[model samples]
Target: MAVRKLEHVGIMVKDLDQSIPFYTEVVGLKHQYTMTHTNGIIRLAFLAGADAQESQLELVEGYEGELAVEGRTHHTAFTVDDVEAEFARIKQLGVPLRDTEITTLPNGARYFFFYGPDGEFLEMFQPAPGR
Candidate 1:
């Protein structure tokens, strides 16, 4: 069977309250909804883009262990109008950045990496205009 589309990316976070603001305020995603498991062991918050068609970011709370190393590379990137402006905004927030400066590709795609409260890597990308 072929996959249709990516619905969302799940991230196990330590605290939903702390993580939720970052995606909503910094990443510019809207909080769609939140739910608690029947067992009360897990709580999830769903954040989505302004365009409903875009995939969402799910934040899962109640996990106790360290995030997997693979999680760092398994990052989710959000498209931005300007990578430089986003980078400057993140810098102003005093967030920890994986890259000291933004990087550009031959195709004119620009990006930079940063970490979340749980050390989860996140990227902001700007594709070449008119492409």
Candidate 2:
């Protein structure tokens, strides 16, 4: 019940080498870091403005699907104090979920995907301490 703030918005990209620079240089955002998903498929890169504490942009690469030119957003994540709690609560409410279990990233952050009213991807994310 305590969704704190917007965590990040994920955008599907064909190449991180190209998207990373575009967001950092052209968009005037700072590249925070990059990491590969635990699934060993998707590559993720985060970017932020002057305030790293705020919401960020995530560039996702290695998706084996067609990327739409207009709507490239992959998912929208919201910061949660407890991802597990939220996941349970959402399930109890009968919300459609994309992930059966929470996914732990290399950085220790945990997240799970759920479907919104329109079938758009939404995430409940609990960031690792100090992140």
Candidate 3:
């Protein structure tokens, strides 16, 4: 089967109260809606950027401590026009970055990683021209 675009990235957060504001205000995402699972074991808050059709960021709750493996979940990357400017903005916001310098992948994509409110890894990428 052919894979379509990504639907959403599920992230487990300690508290939805704080995570919601961070994603909306800091990350510049729009809050769509929230809903709990049928079994009531988890609650999810879906968020989207200006383009609602793009992939979404799902803030998940009630599953803390269960998935604590680093590098396993890895990161979720968002495309940007200028990686440097975005890096500066994130720094100006007092967010800690994974590295002091941006790295260019073999495919010529520049990116940097940072930790989220719940210690999840997040990345910002800028692909090469014509990519």
Candidate 4:
């Protein structure tokens, strides 16, 4: 048996229309598609980066529960080419940022945090060269 790769990360949201644009336009992901769950009460939207081989982000809406600051999922991170540039772009969008500035890890990786439309935690990660 083998696990090839992570399929996607599911994030609970309050609305699809708002979250879709945020993930697409703001986060730089493409809306692969949107569908309704078999239960008929829940709606789901799948998004991915320009590279289809990458894992996707599944946005679940219509769930009857509180979207706590700390939910079942901690946070969803996106791989970015330039952490500083992305941070500046997000800042210009007036999005609520969790980090005052980009952080550099011991391995030379960099990242920053921010909130989504539904108050979900999100991050932009840039790996060190050749990582």
RMSD of each: 14.0, 1.0, 13.1, 13.5
Error of 4 at 107 (Å): 41
- By lDDT, the better pick of 2 and 4 is 2
> On residues 3-69, what C-alpha lDDT tens digit does candidate 3 reach at each position?
2345456677878899999989999999987776544677768799987878778787886446545
lDDT of 2 by residue, 19-91 (tens): 8888988999999999999989999999998778889999999977664688789899999999999999999
> What pairs collide in candidate 2?
none
Q: TM-score of each candidate?
A: 0.50, 0.96, 0.51, 0.53
In candidate 2, stretches whose alpha carbon ends up further than 4 angstroms from where it belongs are: none
- 10 residues in a row with least lDDT, candidate 3: 1-10
Q: Cα lDDT of all candidates, in order?
A: 0.74, 0.92, 0.74, 0.78
Using lDDT as the yardstick, the better of models 1 and 2 is 2
Clashes of each: 0, 0, 0, 0
Clashes of 4: 0
Measured on C-alpha atoms, candidate 3 has an lDDT of: 0.74
Error of 4 at 97 (Å): 36
